[model samples]
Target: MRRFASCSLILAGGLSIVACTPDQPAAARQPVFEDVSFRQDYSKKYSATDTTLALSHVATDRNGAVQILSSRGLLQPYAGEFLYPGTLVADKSFRPLRDKKIRAISTYRQQRVYLDDKAVFSNAWAGTLYKKHTLPNAKHFAGGKDFSFLVSDGKKLQYLNDGIAWEGSAPAGLIDIVYDARRNAFMLLSPSEISVFSATEHTVTTFYTGKGLTCLALTNNAREWVVGTHAGYFTLDAASGRQRGTLQRKLPCADLTAVEEINGKLWFGSVRGAFMIRPDGKCNYYACKRWLPSDTVIDLAPGADSSVLVLTDRGLGEICFKSMTLADKAAYFGQQVRRRHIRHGFNATLENLEAGNLGTGTLDDSDNDGLWTCMYLAAEVFRHTVTGADDALENCRESMDALERLYTINPMHGFPSRSFERRGYKYDSEPWRRAEDPEWDWKSTTSSDEAIGHMFVYGVMAELMRDEDLKKRAVVLMDSLMQHVLDNNMYLVDWDGKPTTWGKWNPEYVNARPAMVGDRKINSSNIISMLQTAYYFTHREVYKEKAFELMTRQGYYENLMRPMREITTAPASADDWSKMLSEAWNHSDDEMYFLGYWGLYRYAFNDTLQANFREAIIDHWQAERPEKDALWNIMTAVTGAQQFDLDEAVWYLQEYPLDLVSWKVKNSDRGDIMKIDTNFRNQHTAEVLPPDELEICRHNANRFGLDGGNGGATEYSAGDIWLLPYWLGRYLGVIGTPDVVKP
Candidate 1:
């Protein structure tokens, strides 16, 4: 669950840094990928939160298969039992793609490495590189506060933390370091380089001479490691420094850039493509261009413990690591089945899909298409939910609770509908201001509380796919929102005797003349989606009727979906985040656009969205969009390269990087409201912070919430997590499970 940072603006009082300078254009940015060294360094950052975060160098799936992304932007599928989507990524990218296609995913657990704090040293995230803040450094830090960046000088591990150093030695040519919980030593990997150095044995006595380990990564077992080189891919003994076996790839000198052992087999990537070498000497290869993208392999990355990111010359991509294996897939299937049963009603799922039921009710659920969307996903999507795993049911429960809290909230204090229940309603910041009125500049008529709920609602549903009880509750909650809207005709808009509710920013854009809509303006967000799905499974009229009615009213999409669906990118300015987080920026071309296309897509897999409105969205995207850096641009480039077309959404992702602000405007600084004004705020969190508060904020922004919680303010927050459930859901799957929706 994420911390709901109050969007309340303080409006004054704080050390605000103008993040961007007016001298530069709003879209200005540098190329992130232009630097080869940087591209090769994607593995530098380890975040359990990054679902689509990519590492282009080496990637794999749950089945220990490899995925080789080509230069042309196509995805290559491998022949192996994949337990997850992309590859098995861990704090260590546990396994690389088994040669561009077949990959392996880990059933996460506490991989304890017995480290002899005295003899050998290793950082959990990155092998020991420097002293981290404290003298007797064991401090687990997150965010940039104590974020460790490691680069080896090829002999010993050097650490950098708070201007101090914690030095430790490893085997000669120690290419990779693994935490050995059993011996409490750092295991080094190189062809002939496996040594359990006790701070005394800096050199290796037992070296597998025949191996030339060029690339290395850790595995689920801190005691073991995945090693790749010109010789072949293989896993080695950490304690004994013995070769387990040669990974069975057919390539003469398999350029195994990545490797992971899962389901009792080996997976690795080479120059030409990806491959999976079974224990029995069988194999599977995922040819880059032959399947999708070009043949050039670049970099690979793994996220948290969930998604796998693959970086190529074009852009980055994400895939589930565990979904590629038989065990994890079976486990994921069981979890989804349980979740489906837990859902209050399966019919509700269909009802929402066909009818649409969000943005128009007292009981709010931001992700309108939850029902059908969940249906669109594959069973393997819930792989992380298997009974016993890292960040398991506890994660799902906490996430659901946060979403429920979001729905019950009322925002803007007493100036508007201060109550948490009707929290999203806005007030007349500037009365007599009307979109139709010539003098009416777009003014804030309502709070974006509802808009931001997209994160909570979508996150809840995503958690449901993995958790049973939460999934059922989520469905029922969606059903209730739809019922509320149907009973009240105008789906949850602030039509309280007002002619229209004016808005300034769409959820994803900012600065330009803001857009306004009638109080009845609604879209598919807000859990209304469960209706169609419910109807489909139950054959109930209420669900279907309300869904269609909601759709008819919210038919004209707004700015939210545009950015929500826009190619993903990091913000270039504070204004950009504010705009992106506003309801005014929710500019979807139109509801009917995706609607018609969705139907068409069900039948025709290659259908393209040519609606004039979609084109308009592209125009709007380009007009107000900012430029991106190379790393960020890689995403857009992939989109451009994949869809075979150049458009605004793709371009934004491919070229924009957040601008550095010199002038900071924090929501809490100027806020005169109760400290609760701290509600719905941005930047202000950084302003009001004492050293303690800053420490907490640092926690909120880390790879995973190690302190506060997964969704802590300084840990997990609704804002960042929102991007994962909503946008990623579409690209990944909806209720349309991969097996069931292949239709």
Candidate 2:
């Protein structure tokens, strides 16, 4: 529509195009280069006014006959993408899925991907469904064609399969799939389970992954592969299910996606965008903010030319490999350059990864936490404010003479470790497939399975960097892991025939415990991440059930939380920790931890249930007040939904606070460079608290030391981002904050 890239557009149309920098006033720091791009597709606009969602995530088939789209990726502002419009699952007046509740949508030829909007309104939510302006096209392709399943009991899947009848106990949520040449099978993957069925038959090996798979990358060695899961990413033993080594993690984080190998370089995407390591073991990243114009790259497909195609929030953008430009911003304070705000080198993030800190290798001196900062910094693309920051994004152009090879389209979908290596990571291991356990006593945690999970997750991210042919192969790899990890023997429930500890502790229902015991059981959080994909691919009720079960049956307040009553201090691993909190309670059944509680709370839905959770949260956090600290206390207030005296807490939080994300986009209509979304003013209730107040609430807790034994903040997790949700909730006056209109 408008040509704006590579040209000096002092001012394009009505928008100011200034140089980028925080030093200059926001007005002066306009977008000097709009990062504009256009696809010279003589194919014409397709006459498809397709009033549908754009590609949130995308993948090209090995056959090149179809483009698979997921419409969902990581945890970002928008719920998910609206990629494919063909399979909206409709009745008569057909249209792409267009309901507000339809959180995400992706496409891959015949297959489609979807994620439910746990927020806004759900199917179980009756009031908003019948609204006058609601989307008439709202429907569930998996649960039922007519969009009948409600949110309260709706079993939204992580992925779906071609068979629509909804297979039971098949591990509900399925995400990616791949063809396995070794076994001539199709590996079906999901959060709850992984099923590898013969392309010619249905022989399978189902298994479970607690935190869900982060990525899946295939090695040049066809027979083996890598899998990144909740714990970490690692290479796997093709036959033995042994982990090679972990390539990513710092304390821990999940939701890994995207992976690829270009010109001897390896690449992968995690929370934000892509990353890469050079042939010589150097690493680098892509500046998504400058290169692709999206904070996160849902999918990265290599092009015929040594370039990469990135699917992001804005649209499909490409970075030409041969046309590489080292990002360098001019130093204003240095010599008052001609440009008001200087633009730095082409892509600093990439350079950093490959060269280590400040143009060095892994030996450049960095600690675990330091290494993580570098990784996250590289991933960080330009913030929305356009202050010229490197958010996560990486790339590789020069192709292998366009030979591009990747995951197969069948089962056993994954790569062997012999592919690529990073500064602190290597392809030194194989896939991990643990057998199931009926009970506890024999259960034990192994670094191997956990490591492979991480690899699978990263593999997904790497495939995104490949060409169309390779992208399709990546899906096949995903299918293999799902077959073995998600459904077949999910829960990693096997105890090597030892006395199982599963079901050892009572699954907490609200505030009550049903039964109890100990010895740590197989967990299920990792499977949750995979569900978003399964819901889209197969639409299996079983997938939805798993997510629902985890969300409902388990929680931090009652089920998995460590009893502080008899606590000495927080334990790192389950093995190191004690079961009894204060001698008053002892865990005998399943071993529940903070991860379970946090993971479960992530996908909570329902008005009454959410309220119920609110009460439990209040009770628990208030208890932790004894050891109240900034991190822990603020976390409790945000997620727990506890009530507090507003103006009072507000003053304190503002007086001393950390970071508070604003959900509403700021407007620039106020004669200022940017504007604030005042809509949140009327969203809060008098009884509820604001972010500032929320901060104050925590500090106050720290003062008296109420629940936590007055301890300090625990390591922050992605869950910490809940601040976005909390602020958004408050701004909308949906539950908290003063609902009084500003004007």
Candidate 3:
């Protein structure tokens, strides 16, 4: 296991002992399986302004195509289509199934059967019709083995097989009928009882009775029967009418509207949403716009390609699963970043999307453009260092060009602008200033976040890149940025000749904040990291001099070493700024601090300082463990800690939704999460929801925020948010290459 901190071969004069190349692989890496879980949601809006709100049932035919029953008839999903309802039509019938009114539908081994008030029909089987007995106003249908079927009109239950019909005692309050092939019987579900009618005996016998049964499903193994009710659901042994377990109520939602057994997993639908019982007993809840068009789940069924189709009041949510490795996911995100997230060489957001359509969006600038670009740049640098991919190198070069332009675009010598755009197209209200070139505009008021990101990437490039020009340019940029701070009295001077609000690292401004305020610790940590990075890369004595001065003379060491538990809200007597800054945990500071850790620990002035930096990083990681953040966990691994929640980090990566649309998601009213009292960190629950269930946001946003998002108007880049940590893990040898061939 080669640590990057110890792997650096460069001496004080920047002499390399060995040339790094793509062929050089890291040793002692653990291989991760390629089969990772990810979700793909399929939905269609009813109208331009309305989602489909009348879906009733969903099913999959033998051809592995999904059919959703809604008020508008059967609907199917088409490839490359979104937000358009594709109504299903009969294959060879004179009258299409879409035109005729369908009351009930079912799929058997080789046939898709449907029934109206008049007669039952099939798309596959064509047995002799039962002309002797007329249909008894059938409203439900279930297909059995070899054309054997059952129908119920909510009053009587009948078995129709081989042109003959046998009447069975109809259970009172009949709701649904399902065929159990293993038992060769029809399971009749009523409000409070289950009656099994054997085809051989032709007799209906009471099997089980419950207080408020709504639906029933036999497990795939035919060992247990799951029954749902208005309150919750429970299981029973299939052989006997005995309870398999106690009434299980700890679910995503207790009000079970529908239930289905798919792929050996029991999926429950409620008025609020749909959830699946994982093997571990915890529920993988699927709610909000991210999973469904609406949260009112009406039905659940097995879907095509190992997926689940959730029919809600508003359209369908097809949760599809595809086998992928972390590397495969990285490649997918690489294509995603190059496809739409690039804006003038900087990784940017796709804003003002039309109904979450990926093609109907435009790249837009943000306040932290430099920071975002540098994060993406670091990802590319890590990728180039690991795989030596030409595309990754090209990406790094292009982004490096953009970052270098930021320093020169503005009048200040080393003050990097937040972002830049062509002449007057900039629409943001941020302070946009004119560049020397009349055709361009540059944003001002760069903060310490950007500085830290810049230093981190620069240090990474200086340490890892094989290209001499890039390494030298990185060192030069580091020297320039640090010299600017030193020349301007340890501050990033803005266009108005004043320190940017967040760029002040001078002792006067930093020490003024109370000890408990997070700004004090974060500022001290970031400035020292910046100085160390500058000194390490350029071997400049001034950077080292200032770093030691900040540590010994100005009490910055004590500030940085303060235990994370000691950080709290400012006292009542504190100033308004300090109070506001310490009101709650700033997740943006976490991003800044972790990003700074790369340069802080790796580019330390001495081994003893490196040890202290490692301790500080581990302390911060301990505080952040509850979030289960992949980036934070992976970044903490750089410090060589024994345990950094690697499993949680992998879970974070695997559970992150592929859909980056900023769709409105609400979970504050969820019954599953155990709500905790408010605290300084604002953690809403004992455990945070998976990334996909929450709103789409950058790593800087709080993972515990229950609800947020614009109504599907924006899409975020995967570059900084996803690729950075994955590639960092790869470079650090904590994550291995795909176990299988690249797909």
Score each candidate by Cα lDDT: 0.31, 0.30, 0.80
Estimate the TM-score for candidate 3.
0.91
- The candidate with the higher lDDT, 1 or 3, is 3
Number of colliding residue pairs in model 2: 216
Error of 2 at 9 (Å): 58
Q: How far is candidate 2 from the true structure (C-alpha RMSD, Å)?
A: 34.0
Candidate 1 — what's its lDDT?
0.31
Model 1 ranges with Cα > 4 A deviation: 1-388, 405-466, 491-539, 550-743
lDDT of 1 by residue, 215-271 (tens): 665564555666777655666675555768666344422665655443344545455
- Tens-place lDDT per residue, model 3, 1-743, is 22333433433322122112212224344333234444433343321113533556666777876666655666665442343233333223324676766776666674456776656676554543322224557777787766677877888776777654697558888888888889898899999899898988888999998778888888858888889998888888888979976888778788888888888778898887889888888888887666676677777777667778777776667776767777778888898899889999999999998767676898888989999999999999999998999999999899999999999999999888999999879854558988889999999989999999999999899989999999999888888888999999999999999998889999998899999999999999999889988877676667877887888889898899899999999999999999999999999999999999987877666555677788999999999999999999989877767587778888888778777889888788776688999998999999998887889888899999998999989989899999998888888777767656365
lDDT of 2 at 349: 14
In terms of lDDT, model 2 sits at 0.30
Q: What is the lDDT of residue 6 in candidate 2?
A: 32
Identify the superior model by TM-score, candidate 1 or candidate 3: 3
Instruction: TM-score for candidate 1, please give it.
Output: 0.27
- Cα lDDT for residue 340, model 3? 87
For TM-score, the strongest prediction is 3
Q: After superposition, how far is residue 80 of candidate 1 from its true place, in Å?
A: 46
